[model samples]
Target: MRLSTLVYMHKNMEKMEPLLYDVIVVGGGISGLSAAARLKQFHVKSLVIEAASIMGGRMRTHQETNLELGAQWIHGGVNANSLYNYAIQKGVLNKENKIQEDSEKGIFFYTSTGRMIDLETSQKAWEIHERIVDESENYPKGGNGVQISLKSYYEKQAKEKLKELRQVAKNKTFSGEYESDLDYDEEDLKLAMDALIIQFEAYCGDTLDEAGVAVYGTSQELPGGDVPFPSGTSSVIRELEKEIDERVMNTKVTRIEWKDDSYFISTEERPEAYRAKHVILTVPLGVLQKKSITIEPPLGVAKETAIANLRPGRISKVFLHFNEPFWIPGEGDIIFLWTKKEMEQGVKSKDWTTRVSSIHELESCPNWMVMWVSGDAAVIVDSIDDEQVLKGATRILRRFTGDPGISVPDKILRHPWLADPLTLGTWSYPSIHSKHQDYYELMRAMPSPENPRLLLAGEHVHPQYWSFMHGARLSGLEQADKIIKYMGKMKPKQNGISAAK
Candidate 1:
């Protein structure tokens, strides 16, 4: 059915007795849309209620430049990722969609004082960082029954490695075999540690002190590297939207009340309430944490505790569209390294520039560059004005590149995901207080799992794939299957008619 026809049907139904849908999927994001689409495939009556004016929640694209404001890359590329495979099957993504890997682009490292580090030294530092990260995968279990943060583990390893490197350099000097020009120094050690923290924050979606070390390598990754859609990430959403014909846009569900073996979903925009035999809530974890929507007969203590334990990850991007490229063509990423003194002063000064981790050239958009700010930095950047953000970005670029004459961007684009009420934040991450079982608890159906009337579906619920688009899509399909099976077990009424009908 066409959207217009669905809208017409909804309007006409609202004027009369409320129709009890078989399933009502809340939040028209990837997860909700996927669930509704799966339900439609089984010929089940379903409706998607979205608070936003358009679909594709976090997979939003900037209409003007055709650039993705959220979820720009498909993390697993074309490997075993279900979302990537689905997009390929729908013909939305093809061979041309593959993005240039980091190795393909020239990467340069620079200190805060505008001194560029040699490639050899930078490579060595990165190698050391990678080695330590790899070792985290084998972090000893049951360490005296005391939990440790990723930060603590990283610091301990880094200190030992730095000591080893310094000892080797000292031995070489004593043997009269040391080359002053090629030797690693204290400055290099500090830069490596700084870079590691910045990169880890981006990966973990929080400061090292917050994420637990136990879940360091719990999430699985696909074989292929990250890839971006040539058009935009929303291309997948467009395809999914085609499969889902019934959706009410701009309908913000304010409350969900369970009564008489059914769910009465209330919206702030309309007087009539929506009735459904089952509901699939796909809102972000952040929204649930904020209590934006009320649930009568509140979720049990176990589920509520799980919700409180999982933290919302945040990340903000600033797209600077320049009239011309300032640096060398195809420069993949320019990483900024802060000295120990600069790091100390930056903490006291609370400078936004200090929060900038790296700037990268967009392969799809040649003239555009993107600056990544994650963790607490994302919150600050999202709250500030565009002009202030641009000023700070300009200063950082000039200082890092040692180019005093670099031109400011002609246009700057950013989306405040952290500040957006609908999202509240970007994704979900395992915090120091989080446990693996918390994910299962969060997704467990209300009342009882045997009779699941209210189902939860989102990335946060996925055990092995949380914090990815594919994870969200898979969770949606899983919930839809649960609803389908539940409906299958229902017998017809005495009149040989279904209660759902």
Candidate 2:
């Protein structure tokens, strides 16, 4: 009976559909969907093919409480403003939908010895770090464009600045200014670097080496910005999906064939030809890194070089939901743990004793803190089994709270962005050794003389805002405009041919 049932199912499989579209979008992420929505506004019929079942690509929200997994806060919302705001202007984000920005009050400071320190001292240390960065970068409060790669210049400048600062620490010079300066030795600087390594890894779920250092640019290259979140980034995605007349979710595009001035896209879920006059490739840099999709005749040398050279980063978020807040008490809450060992070795009991919170309110809520693992730390965390990662995080929290009796959280939310087949990484990070701008031209490449339909857009292409959400949104808008312009030029010709016929 089982054999007969299998035979009947195989024999009755549905036939494939050969659907052609005005434009074929290869990804369903923020950029792709945003572009598709704009295309619809231009009265262009579009098709979006996504490998995942849900939309909003990396701008993910959890199912249980709708907490954001991919992009939580509206970083730079007031300044850059989230793209979701534009969607809201067009009736996307509703009245009830809002973004929350709270202040952090419960401040704790810890040391390498696992001893809690005075909050005033930690603030002083951070202030010193900020001042040094400001001096080294020649930071302008007016926000003028000071183009320099901060990482490269700051590290180089650290030698001289640290030397001078050390003298000030010994001599007690510049009382008001030098008081906050951390009297860090060479070893202390290394410790700070290790801490930063963990911080960046948690931010982008990438490795330190894989992280990019923007060189030849001013301090503004990686200038500090506000945290921004879309009013309803996910809702905007759903709305945009509606714009595409035809969309195939859970369909992984594996190959692209170009001939006769047209593009053919094929997917594993459906064995058929999906043709398009033009193709907009919005896949993340990581997807292309995996070589998941085969391009017939291959992308040109320049484009291929850029695609192959600039690799994507692996990033993910691990969210732990506790029953109540235990350690901190107010808005804008943050806890910084000063430890000697790497984050992956697991948060030691001693390390947590030094945990300090900037937000007092955090103590009132569930004893929960979201530790962002990025760079090398991200690689380590993501590579481990889920249970092990959770246990490690729990141990860290218990140690920080000095609560050995603390129990595991009620819920654990984690996004396997690196494990995701479609999105191989969380976001793009500029490599420390390579010049990312060199590959910028490839990202901007359009199909040549014979076929001018192929185009590329993503966060990596945005030199200034490469790893940022704003960069992705901006790239989508730019590409959409280019495609629209290209189509406008073809419209008259099409009309003329019709009249002749």
Candidate 3:
């Protein structure tokens, strides 16, 4: 049956019978939408309840500038990634989309003292940083019996590599290998080490000290590299929204009560309660951590423990739109390297600008530059006003580029994901106290897997793909399939028909 027809029938049936549905998904993000779409394929009566007025939770895009305000990249372009495949099939991604290569070809690295690092030295530093990152992954796969923070591991590797480089330079000088002094100084070496750490922190969406080394390489990456939607990431959400738009309701689910085989979902605005045989929760990890929704007959000790251990990571972006570009065109990215002394001073001053990872020119929108911030700085930026953020970003850009007369941005765009009640934070990260098993625990269905009443689906619950869009999409599909199989078993035996089919 067509989904529109099914939706119409369900609406009419609601008047006579109780408003019971086969499944009611809470949180209308990618995970919830995907689940609802999959259920619609099987002609299952399902409804999606979203707290926000609009769909596409974190995948928000600015209509005026066509710039993504949240969740921009389609990490892991093509390979076996379902999200990428779906975007490609839906014609949302095109040649305009750029592949994010690991090479630092067009990037310029500048020190806080207004000195740009030479291309050769910068390239060499990047190569060493990448090698160290790859090596750190071994810790999680039993390379070391004792797990440590990524910060500690990175420091150890950086020290060793720096010592080795110094020794090599000494050998070359002693042998009279024709060279004009040392290619880099001690200050330059320090900048490379510290800058790489900040870059990794931005990728993980938190400070390295808070992230566990044991979970470093647990998440798998697709082969084709990351890609961003030129039009916007929300295009993918819109595609999925088409399949289940009628089944979606804009309302906040405040409390959920499960008794026997039925579940009651209460909303903040509506007085009437919605009944369902099963509930699929796809809310963000931040929402769950905050306990924004009450789950009656509380989620057991294990699930509660998982929620407490896994932390919500903070990541925010500051977009500055310029009338004319001050820096050279085609310079892919501008990385700011802070001196140890400057970093120490900033801590005392509460300078949030020190936390910015890099400033990159948008490929699709050349006039716009994006400043990446994470960890404590992201939280600080989220709390501050836009004028303060603009001033801070301008100060950093002028200082790094040695251009004191750079004009202020005509417009600025930013989203306070950390402060936003709906999101609370950006994504999930494995804290020092978190374990790999916690993800599986989060995925476990309530009561029992054989006869499930409450199931969880979100990016945080994916064992190997946590914090990725594809992971969330896959988790939704997995839970939907579980419900279909369970319904198939529960079907009456009078006819040789299966609900799953």
Candidate 4:
């Protein structure tokens, strides 16, 4: 009766049920849901089996509001117009909001020594980030097209910039003692500056040095490109689920065994098995990495390696509700902490682990402060208690505002994607030192076998759009098209029913 008991029962799915569906989808996240919904467009019969109770795998909508647990924003803009705009057109997104494009506001610079600096220095860092991407465009050897880690590459470039900084200070006609301090070798200063930039890793979930350049290099770029959230991101999925729930099997799938002609899906909640002609695996990279579900004949080596090696972006979201807005009177952009040590060691100690205690100033939330925890900072925070996380974040806010006695947050909402069993980590990120080719290879879509029985569709599988919600949507539609083509190849069986339906 219980989920655990059913899991260990070791039932054979093939013996429980005969063919019952045209297609059975494993993992009812965005990809699975989207694929199943698209099947409806073609008047195909399908069922979705989810490990979790509800659908929308990572795109979880808060019960009370428009907030999303996993994906919060439409990262790639006009590029996302097809996917995002469709969501709006279909009433999945109520209204689209656009903010000013200039980085002039809500951008601040900090030194490794903990001194706040002007925006000019920050702009230089942004420029360097661009250079890192540009530099990665060329590669030495042919390999899997993956995003190489940018940390080392960026650190090298950052050193050059830091050297230039010192040079400028020394050349000042009225140079003071501070100029003398800037005379240190670029290597020494670069190391310090590298620590400051590690704070940005908090947004990506890995130290810059460990982050792959390949993953970040292919990002869509545009001047004043708009960033949009689903007014409430959670609602989009809720809207999507409304059309698919009638057929979704809202439970955990332990094993799927396919014999010559049909595939069998077994769930713990029910002893009955569901058989289908085809199965669409919409599981996220995180879930695949966890080995949560077993597939007969196993997924191929390429897909398995991708499932294991493609590091899920280590991201966590912390929402702090305040009684009243206190810090950054009118700022709307999120403030970042530029520090020397990486996130793991930056704001953590024995008293707080997985505590992203510093880096405040959210331009998005007028009165509320949200912490976008990534990389080591996210890992550190996941290790601690909620109370500690709350205290640590508050302390950072207080310090940033130059107000040591900042009031405690009214409510603290944290999503531990790393710790969650269903979601082992956040979306995909580049593996350590891996190249862009490797990532692209992972993104390359593959149809099932010589006949195309099984299909792979998800954000991770979408080369250019991987990691974004738009990527997930595109993969879904693409898989649907492939399925349609595959179905066309088969002639109607001489029997009573269609081969698939």
| Top lDDT hit | 3
Local accuracy of candidate 4 as per-residue lDDT tens digits, 1-501: 354554443343335444387777777777777777777666677777777766777877666644556676665455235556656666654444545556555555433333554544445555655554456544333245444456666666666766667668767635555544542434434433554444446555555556556456454433325555645665666666665523534467776777767777767655336777777777777777787878776777776775666677776677777777665564534343434444345456532323342344455455666676666667667767788878876666655555566788877766688887777777776565444455455544443334656667777777666677777777776676566666773345567664221
What number of backbone clashes does candidate 3 have, counting pairs of residues 3 or more apart or in separate chains?
Answer: 0
Q: Which residue runs of candidate 1 sit more than 4 Å off their true CA positions?
A: 8-16, 95-100, 137-146, 171-176, 179-183, 489-501
Clashing pairs in 1: none
Whole-model alpha-carbon lDDT for candidate 1: 0.80
Question: Which stretches of model 2 miss by more than 4 angstroms?
Answer: 1-17, 78-84, 91-107, 131-161, 173-197, 200-205, 215-232, 331-368, 449-451, 489-501
Q: What is the lDDT of residue 162 in candidate 2?
A: 56
Better of 2 and 4 by lDDT: 4
Can you give the lDDT of residue 448 in candidate 2?
Answer: 58
Task: Give me the candidate number with maximum TM-score.
Answer: 1
Task: Score every model by TM-score.
Answer: 0.91, 0.77, 0.91, 0.80
In candidate 2, position 313 carries an lDDT of: 72
Which of the two candidates, 1 or 4, achieves a greater lDDT against the reference? Answer: 1
Error of 4 at 221 (Å): 4.9
In candidate 3, how many Å is residue 410 off? 1.0
Off by over 4 Å in 4: 1-19, 63-65, 92-96, 102-104, 109-115, 118-148, 167-192, 214-216, 219-224, 270-272, 332-365, 432-449, 489-501
Best-to-worst ranking by TM-score: 1, 3, 4, 2
lDDT on C-alpha atoms for all candidate structures: 0.80, 0.58, 0.80, 0.61
